[model samples]
Target: MALAMTDASMTDATITLPAIAPRHARDGKLRRMLSRMAILVITMVLVVPVGLVALGSGAGVIALPYEMFELARRAPLLFPAHMIASALVLLLAPAVILTRRRPEFHRPLGRLLGLFVVIGGLTALPVAIISHSTPLARAGFFAQGLVWLYLLGAAYVAIRARDIPRHAHLMTAMVAVTTGAVWFRVITGTAIALRLPFEPVYAASAWLGWMLPLALVLSNPRAFARLLSR
Candidate 1:
């Protein structure tokens, strides 16, 4: 779900053109390998600890870092239910990513992933609507849930029609939104760590977390139009 960008290394080596070309080629290939490895490492970091903490909080074995939600006091279990289901989405994301590379396993894992998405989205919608946050933040949060459900549904429709490319594009967009939870925490957590103003960052994260990723996925408007049209 969380894809790390490729890191290109710069060198100050003085060299002749004859040797430089081959060296650069080797460096390019190495960079690509490192990029893939970095993506996996980041995906793991996004999933494992965060997912476990959320899941543990729901189980009452760990404390939630934020203030008590009004929803929690009212229902006693609804907040935990939301967190646990969201945690499942994060934990299961990697398996879905990996299985996509394997044609035989892809459909089965996709079905499982879809099941969790529905549960997660269902649990999140109510919490988002009644969340104790600024109105703008709430709207952004609510939109995230709605868009998550919508894109995934679109993806399922695309695949059902045997439109592989459209399905892949839609799934890519859905994954971008799915990882917004991680991005939200990352943005706010960094702001907290830096002793920056929390309120603005928190509110901005609500939209930026999902929108930024989705924007990147759809950066080429014409290509994206074609993708959706298919």
Candidate 2:
């Protein structure tokens, strides 16, 4: 009787051990799945605007004489820096995508992108201040300059602290802001496609593209609580 009771207890423990381990493993798997889904959804949201801008009437329809004239007319003193920054930002997109799989490639590529952002911001700042564009355009340019400054500062801090999370957050913010032009074009194209009113839509899109991600970062529970408490 005693031996039988001991054997039963040992059996129960053995059975329960596997069950407990599996439960924890399942929880971890679920968490990972959710994280991946969040990243995928965000990626798609960002990618769609860029893809549309590159494919639609925005920059894609190059032969449209009126569009060319408009682009040329708006090409201000900061146009060259804007073009360079825009090109670098676009180039970094592929690197970022590639880094999703090959994370080892991320640091070097990120550092390069950081350098480009700094140069872009420094060159573009003066132009933005002196730009004689609409109030909205000036605001956009100023916002972009601030984003670039943040990116540069964040990258420096990340390097100093060896904090990957901070590095990623800053890079995400940089991409979000740098892609405003693409979003602007996308909003305009989308409006035209849907036969909706254009001017308001474009303005709304530009502002949202600049503000939304920053808002998301700020509104994150961890960050928000800290910010609000302070």
TM-score each candidate. 0.78, 0.62
Total backbone collisions for each predicted model: 0, 0
Error of 2 at 95 (Å): 1.9
Top lDDT model: 1
Assess the local accuracy of residue 175 in candidate 2 as a C-alpha lDDT between 0 and 100: 69
Weakest 10 consecutive residues of candidate 2 by summed lDDT: 221-230
Please give the CA lDDT of all the candidate structures.
0.77, 0.62
Tens-place lDDT per residue, model 2, 1-230, is: 99999999999999999999999978866766675677566556765445443334333343334633455356543445455555565557656645744667976776777776776677566655555545676566677777767876875798689876566566666666666666666677788999997656755765776676666754563542222221
Q: Pairing residues by index, what is the TM-score of model 1?
A: 0.78
Choose the strongest candidate by TM-score.
1
